[model samples]
Target: MEALLIAIKARILELAPEFLQFPLGHLLSITPVISVFAGIFALTTWIERKGLGRIQNRLGPNRVGPVGILQPVADGLKMIFKEDVVPRSADKIVHFLAPILLVIPTMLAFSVIPYGNRLVPIDLDAGILFFFAIGGSAELIVFMAGWSSRNKYAMLGAMRAIAQMISYEVPLILSSIVVIMMAGSLSLVDIVAVQTGGFWNWHVATPWGFVGFLLFLTAALAESNRSPFDIPEAESEIIAGHMTEYSGFKYALFFLAEYLGLFAMTGLAITLFLGGFHAPFPFLNWVPAPLWFFGKFAILVALFIWIRGTLPRLRMDQLMGLAWKFMIPMSLITFAAGATWHYAGKGLLAWILCTPMLLGSYVYLGTALTKGQKVSKRVYRFAD
Candidate 1:
């Protein structure tokens, strides 16, 4: 990022002469760009609720406006006026700061997600690395919220929350490493550009690319704390986990942080696996780039909602086991396979389709046998 700053400064200075030449509209146009994004995020807030509502077969936010399009707006108003309540037993200072802590990292993470052609807020050379580094910031804030509450349930929730997030973060970074290796560049724009041609060019279809997509998605699911991986907030177990003591806008801060995190994760996935802002159709890249970015992103947002409705949360032990047992071993095996394939100089199509079958057969067969043994034990119990 520093190396690029030399040209960056020169370009900005070059534009400064023009900015002085025209006062109001020229400099002010940048304001609308920021507003557009903020609006987009706000719309996404609505989309998640309305979409999740439809999937779960119920009304989400109908009373506020027609089709509930203005529900987020109404909800925002309610939170703003609502009384701020902090537990009497809680530490005063940290409780005051925790909401800000939760939202700041989420805001930072979005800055690295490129929107479309040359539309990124800031494009660093180490974009993907910067992403993970910022992504981990939430765990810290989450733990703080749990600890500062000074509630027993809150403390236990914080520990569980930390454990779940930390475990999933490993596979999340490793899975993304596969993309860095394939694209040979960590910049999110460069990664998307490599998939510019069409659906086939998208990395998710290639061998290492496909495995990377699966691994990345699975890890991202955990990272976002979605169902089937949401051990932290299980009502049956942890009872809203780290945020149990929060209320009013304070609770809303954590709530918005979660949706923002989900929004960012979907955008990252689109950028990495689904070809970012490129049109799914090969020739469609010729169309304006923003359409593709929004189109793909909206589809992914729906998928995330669908997942929330369709899946059940994993047990805490099961969640832990998945990271250490399933995700870790699978990530290692996939990494090695990709490395070996690269070194062997095998054709991309051939290796991706064939390698997982040939290379992983032993492991697959052993896993099958173990499943069979479990099934037999269940049958025996039934018979007895």
Candidate 2:
């Protein structure tokens, strides 16, 4: 199957016109990636809504195409026709440019992600650093949207978003560093190459890797402004937060950037910890490489959606505390554990040595963080 794919790609390259061959070929290659993610972004909205609906015991978006599959289509049309509203007092230029800035960086991060064995768009030696460097700009973009709007709520939301991002960003990068240390390469493809063989070889299967994966997932959710960590746009409190002044397609662009960012981060997680496009088991190698990649990607996306349905947003103080007081320290410990495991020869002896340390730190810190916090049990009252 791999050979066939290579042959087909070579044939297509041969068919290209001589003069425009290289540039046009590159453009053609990237077109499908952009289109696929754009479509995925649209579909995700419907999927998330439906998933959340099921969780909450409600039917979601059933009026469009069967199962409301066309809801995103309808949404796009509505946004296109809707009036674009700009606050008269706003900085028109920056207000206009903020979404574009936000989206471009998110899209650029996609270029470094290895979708399959030979499917990377631009494989840099420092791909992991490049990914995070581009991703870090999102906080600035959020600030731009808020500051340009000149609305207090928007500005406040931007401040909160920045603080949250800064806090989570530390652990996010630290957790991934553990993987880089294990793989001994910053290139994402190299990272995956080291993990090949089967599911057990994947970093997430190790004790430290497992802890790092959990920390990475937590930091990812916070960084992306996803639910339970979505305090930035808490509709009940901030009325769309940094997006309060945006309307019509401008609003839709913000939504697009957000979901695209989510997809990119999830894809990175798949690459870093879930073994990229590698099949889970030896027999599963019969599955196409890209299928293996997207299957894992989809499951992670579904997990994010499930989390949104199950958890309530954290209070601002709690959110910041989780990152600084708990996740950072835990990620640092995981990093140390990874180094120890590596030097100890990656044997059962290594596991025996490291598992207790990792588990003990997690329990100690987790208990310390949650100590004295009251768990409220709800009591239902009925009036007859």
Candidate 3:
């Protein structure tokens, strides 16, 4: 299948006119990724709305088309026609540039993710480093958006974004380092390649890998500003956070950058722990690799949407405590477990040693953290 794609690409390049060849080749390579994500971004809005509607016992955006499939189209039209408003007190130049900065880092981070076998856009030796370095710029963009808006609420939200992103980034990178250690490579393709096999061979099925994956997912939710970690943009508290002053298409661009960031992060998660595009069973190899990759990706996306629908936002203090006191320590221990497993030749004895260590840490931390918090059992009351 990879050979077929290569042949097709080469044939298309051959058919192009001389002047357009190089540019056309580059365009062909990048166009599909961009177009697919754009379409997915549109579809994701509808999916989240409808999923949340079902959770909340309401109909969401059903008027636009069948099951609200065309809602994104209507949304795009509305944003295009609406007035782009700027506050008189705002820094116009920085405000104009903020969304572009936000979206660029999100898109660039995807360049290093392995979508399938031999399907990376640009394979760099330091791809993992490149992903995190580009991703870190998102905090600066958030600050830019908030400061340029010149709103107190926006500024506060920006501060929260910085705090949350920086705190979680520690565990995020640490958890991923376990995978890097196990794979013995910093390249994303190499990471995925090491995990390829039957379902059990996947990284997440291992003792330390499972723990790392959970930590990674927790930190990822915080980093992407998804709920219940979405305190930065809590609507009840701060209108739209950094986006309070943005109107029309600019507001839409913020939303686009957000979902694009979600996609990129989820892709990275799949690459690192879920075996990228590898089939679960050897016999399932008949299915295309990209399909396998996206199938896993869709499950994780839905999981995020489900979490948003079900969980309430965390308090700022609680959020920081969770990151520093819980996730960071757990991530460090998981790295140690990975090291032990690697040295112990990943034998049954290694599993026996690490499993207890991981479980003990989780139980102890969870108990200690929730010690003073209220605990209640829900009593359901149906409408009469």
Candidate 3 on 1-384: residue-level lDDT in tens? Answer: 765776788899999899999898778768878889989999999999999999999988889878789999999999989999999999999999998889899988888888777888888888999999999999999999999999999998988899999999999999999999899899999998888779888999999999999999989999999999998899999988898999999999999999998899899999999999999998998888889999999999999999999999999999999998899899999998999888878889889988998999999988887789886976678833
Better of 1 and 3 by lDDT: 3
Model 2, TM vs. native: 0.96
Ranking by lDDT: 2, 3, 1
Instruction: Give the per-residue lDDT of model 1 (tens digit) for 221-317.
Output: 7887777677777777767888888878898888878767777787888888888878778766566676778788777767766887788887787
All candidates: TM-score? 0.83, 0.96, 0.95
**Candidate 2 lDDT, tens digit per residue, 275-317?**
9999989888888888898999999999999999999999998
RMSD to native for every prediction? 5.6, 2.1, 2.8
Assess each prediction's global lDDT (C-alpha) against the native: 0.75, 0.91, 0.91
lDDT of 1: 0.75
Evaluate residue 230 in candidate 1 and report its C-alpha lDDT on the 0 to 100 scale. 73
